[model samples]
Target: MRYYFVLTIFSCVFAYEKDLTFSVQAGKTDCFYHKVLPNEVIDLEYQVIDATHGELDISFQLADPVGRIIVADYKKSENAHRHTAALNGDYRFCFDNTFSTFSQKTVFFDLMIDTEENQDKEYDEDKEMEFGANSAESYMMRMRDISESVSRVRDNVSTARRLQELHSAHEARDRNRAEEMCAKVMTWSMVQIVLMMTVGATQVFFLKSLFEDRGSSSYKKLIPGLGSQ
Candidate 1:
């Protein structure tokens, strides 16, 4: 029971992963920040999942705590970045869609902060406790092995979850793009059908007018003596 309680606490402390989706309107920028400690590993992945006018691209920028740009990507559909925090502060992420006048972009992003130092410290603290010189030593060793195995499993699960989320985002983007293309194709096909019908009607009316017989008054307008004849 004690081991389970400690494991729960550990999991809670390391649950700083985030998955987010938001919109960046045309001529505007959207920014977010996450607080991180020094030496923590930061993993960021983002994709422009959907957009108006088939424009699935946006500018991304990441800035350090001291306002220095650590990474910048221009007009990208998807990107990922990994960095280690050198100072303790909030890291800024910005998505820029200012180049688009009327198209808005929908973005999906994943952020993960891994504190390996803290995990190592916790492990060291567990090791510092002196075990009795008896059967308790073997029991303690078994418990430690169990804890380590659980931690490994947890890490694997986290990685799998992140990959699944990213795959889902990609699927959504592709589905939206396909739907948009289908709509455009249908609209243009209808437009072409309407144009063809209009041209056919116009040609028929012109031919009929050309073949029409003129009355005596129309002839008189063309030749002065034709009406009398």
Candidate 2:
């Protein structure tokens, strides 16, 4: 009976490791919805399998349930290999694969939370220790701050994408309009030249007829109008 009881106590104080599989997309960013509580840290570990085809940009934000940011930053090669969290409520991880338009890549994330009551196990069990109210309050405040930052980053990412698409669409429309205007100008110029030629031919024919008639005598009455001929 004592052995079984000891095992139960040990189980409650054990660390947990979770494995999550994420497939990187081509030309799009994927957001993973998650939130963490205080006293727990979300550790993200990733592996790039086929980085030759494309690259990956991973970022994370720790937030509160009501949407506030506490800690947020992109994963850099030097700093993000293993990340530790202080306080967290809703923690979101975003993966941007838009830069890798040529091929698809697979990435894995390992999340571990030190949930064991005595993870450090350094506290002397002979004496009881308790966290004061002040410490608890401080932890709560940190959680809220992290939540807010996460929400802001997420919003900014989406807004930036929308702006980029709008700019591209506007430029394409402007280019098409310019091409149409050039075609119209060329067509109108050809029409103008053809009309001018027809008028010139008509005037020449009338002048020649008048000159011949005046030399004979039939156009003697109209001779005054043929002085310039």
Candidate 3:
């Protein structure tokens, strides 16, 4: 039992998660590479957040060590995929933004690789043995199950919270954009009003000057005629 406990601790320590967040510009592509041994199992999951365009879909592909494309997806917002490494070399995955012209995107991804030989089998066997050992063992098994259930619930809650945050961010971005447009429209309207007022005032002043000039010329002609008589 002591040996098993130590082994489990080591296994948990070795099993780690890799996280990455990156931005891709319009009409560009980003790639990530990872090296793995033969027969290794890989777990991958990703999400796109805060895109200039709504819906936030992007293209992606996974290539093997020898440059063979293994998995590919197009216009996906979120995804989870699993793959088993067949060759002992570097593997690559890429996010593509070829279809977008002006919108940039932010992406978050995670990778988990199983490195131990027959790790799943060993763990399952250990769990079975421990469950059948004694009364205390059975109680421990039940507690472990409960713990696992709680962990799953926690993961669900975390995912929900992430989604909520992303949605809120999207809403705020849209609101800001709308406010900017409103400001521009109001400024243009004010400029137009000012221009119209200036043009109208100029026309009125010119007409009044023309009428005064005509009346003065008539008076001068009449005065000359009266002096000659």
Q: What are the per-residue Cα lDDT tens digits for candidate 1 across 1-229? A: 4565366336533647999999999999999999998888889899999998656899999998899999999999999999989989999999999999999999999999987567766665655553422346665666667667777777899989999999999999999989998999999999999999999997886676566676525446546887676
**Highest-TM-score candidate:** 1
Candidate 2 structure, TM-score to reference: 0.40
Per-model TM against the reference: 0.82, 0.40, 0.54
Ranking by TM-score: 1, 3, 2
Among all windows of 10 consecutive residues in model 1, the one with the lowest summed lDDT is 126-135
Put down candidate 3 lDDT per residue, 152-206, tens digits, no spaces: 5655765576566556655654665687678889999999999999999978866
Per-model root-mean-square deviation over C-alphas = 4.5, 18.9, 8.2
How well does model 1 score by local distance difference test?
A: 0.83
lDDT of 1 at 44: 89
lDDT of 2 by residue, 1-229 (tens): 3353234334444455555555666766676656555666555555443332423344444444556665455633212333345555556666666655665545555555655434324222311232331345464444335534544564476446545544554454456456666888999999999999999997886787777844564455445665456
Candidate 3 stretches greater than 4 Å from native: 1-21, 34-58, 64-66, 70-91, 98-122, 129-137, 172-176, 179-229
Query: Distance from true position, residue 197, model 3, in Å?
Result: 5.0
Clashing residue pairs in candidate 1 are none
In order, the Cα lDDT scores of the candidates are: 0.83, 0.51, 0.73
